[model samples]
Each structure stands twice: as C-alpha cells, then as structure tokens.
Target: MTRNLLSILPVLALCLWLCTAASSRLVKRSDDLDPLEAVVSQLSQTVAGLQAEIAALKSSKADNAVLLALQTQVRSLQTITAEHKVAFLARVDVDVAANAPIPFHAVDFNVGNAYDPLSGIFTAPHSGVYLLSTQIFPQFAGDVLVDLYKNGGIIIRMRVFDSTSPTSESTSITDHANAGDKYWVQVNVGGHIYAGAHSFFSVTIVFPDS
Candidate 1:
C-alpha cells in the first residue's frame, strides 16, 4: 500500500530473477538464452507470491503497534485509580488509657481522604478489597492487647504479655469492604501504650470488588 512497501517488490523480483538465472545455468549445463529465459519466467510467479505476503506482514505490524499503545493507556489509568489510599503515622502525646481507643493525631498522608484524623476512623470510599496494616509501640513490660475494629466488630486482635523491655507489635490483614465501611484500631489492655512517629496505620485498595 505504501511506496516503501512497493519498493520491496522490485527488490524481490530482482533477487528471484538472479536466482533462477543461476539455477538455469547449473541445471541446463549451458548458458543457452532460451533455457535461462524459461527458468526466469517460472521463478516470477513464486516471487510475486512472496512479495504479497511481505505486504500483508507490513500492514499487520502497523495494526499491532496501535493495539500496544491502547493497552499502555489502559494500564496507566489503572495505576492512577490504585492511588485511593490513606496512611497515618504519629506519636500520641496523650496517654491512651487501658481498654480505650487511641486516636492518631498526625496524618502522614491521606490522598483519598478516607481517614479522618479528628475521628481516627477510615471510611471506605468504594466497595473493594483493601490491605490494612497497623503498628503499635508498647513502652512497658506488661500485658498488651490491641485490636482492630471493622464496623465496631473486632476483626483483628493482638495480645502480648512480657516482663522484659518495650517492643513493637504489628498486624496486617486484607478485607473485602463496601462503600462507607469504617475501620479503626483501639487499645484493649495496656497501661502505657506509647505511640510515636514510628507507629502507623495504613489502608489501600488492592482491587475493587466485582
């Protein structure tokens, strides 16, 4: 269809003619003009078929390039949508009494506004599978029991009791959530639960629920 493609046809013809001419001499065992002419004619038909196939391939390559570009755009849009996420990290200066909830004051990042710092609750914006993670720092060597709540129900519960030094405890879980579902963490049993910049709560949509 294009001039560039048309040009290849002539080159193929030339190569075929040369090949036939050489074959004729070897087959006929003589440079007789009549035999060589017959061989060249026979090769023309075969060369023409190859040229047509080449043209079809060139056309197909162009079409495939367009499809690849469209796929790339779709993948880019998916990545943008995946950014519906929220992460909060802070040190609670106020003492979170035992058997109470500790509301984080600092919000490191809430790109989707799903987390409310004042309320310390993360509300899902859409129905999807979400990955939730939390890290806590307990300062004293005592019984520590923390829990994560999903819609006022306990979904994740952690218990640590030791007479040693302070240590960190963390939990990660995935959940299928609906729009407006609330999730939060609370201290179940711990006298001195120290949370600081290292402590964090995060949630991200792994995939939308179908």
Candidate 2:
C-alpha cells in the first residue's frame, strides 16, 4: 500500500508542473502582443506627419512658381513701355525772292498771330533745338539780313553783305518749341536783289539731333 501511494503522488506532481508551464507561455504571448501593437500605432502617427509635411512643401512650391511668373510679366511690361515711346524727325523748306519779303505767317499753319509779317515768322513743327540757315542768290552786289524770332521776340539776327551770287548763312537756335511755336525770317535790304528767276532766298529748318 505504501508503494502505490508514492507512485500516485509522483504522477500528480508532474500534471501540476505541465499546467504551470502552459500558463507562463500564455502570459508571455500577451505581453509581446502589447508591445507590437504600440509599435504599429507609433508607425501610423509618423506616416501621417510625413504626409502633412509633403503637402506643405507642395503648397510652398506652387507659391514660388506664381511669384516667378509675376516677376517675368513685370519685366515684359517694362520693356514694352520703353518701346512705346515716340520719337521722330521732320524737314521743311521755305523759298523767298531777294528784297521781296517772303512771309511765313503763323496763321498759315494754324499756330496763331504770334508773329509779325514784316519780321520773319516761322512756326515750330515740334519741340527741339533747330539749326536755321538761309541761301541767297543776288543779280548784283547786295546785302542780306536774316532774323529769327521766337515767342514774338527776336532770338538771333544774321547779316551777309557784298554778295554777288548764291550766299548762305546759318545760326543755331536752342529753343524749346511746342508743336505750334512760331518763327520766321525776312530780307531787310539789298541792291537789285530781284533780277533773275533763280535770284532768290531759301530757308531751311533742320533738327541737329534727330
């Protein structure tokens, strides 16, 4: 009877040890699963943060592109504005008989009566410094006086005497003339100033820096 009791006690102890080992394995599995779940949650949060940063970068890139386009447009507009400015040159000629007064009245060009007919009057075509010159051909020995007037005032007066054939005199007038500024010239006195058909005086207006 004693031997049988010992054998039953050994079998009971072995069954209790197997049950304790199974319980420890289940607890360790549960602890490992908790840590894995926490890792997966942190990885999901990090992915979301990266996605937000990518979106912000895309927005900044778009803003920079828009600014660059605007700058290019501004430069183009400035170039066009510079090209739109108007600049031009004009030439005019007036012929007169020697000793016979040749009148370039301001009223003829619709400028106004700002000049006297007896004193040569020439209307400015545009605002600029004009180089005025006169060429005269006389049949006999004579003298020629060329006068320039501006704003109803005498600006310069030039004279040529003892001229038998074609004679020329030139003078520069620095004047800020509008589109309708008045100017003129006249021959004061000359001997036998008018004889041949070719014997006459001519005036020319030129722009020095056209």
lDDT of 1 by residue, 1-210 (tens): 556667777876887768775775665534666766676777687667767877788889999999999999999777757665444443455546666556777776676788877767888987888888888878777878889999999999987767678777889999999999999888888766775654667787887654
lDDT on C-alpha atoms for all candidate structures: 0.76, 0.49
- On residues 46-153, what C-alpha lDDT tens digit does candidate 2 reach at each position? 545555666677788899999999999999877754533322211122444544345532222322233344444555544545444433443355566755555656
TM, every model: 0.69, 0.35
Indicate the residue-level lDDT of 129 in model 2. Answer: 53
Task: Please report the candidate that would top lDDT against the real structure.
Answer: 1
- What is residue 108's positional error in candidate 1, in angstroms? 1.2
Candidate 2: clashing pairs of residues:
120-184, 120-185, 121-183, 121-184, 122-183, 122-184
TM-score: model 1 vs. ground truth: 0.69
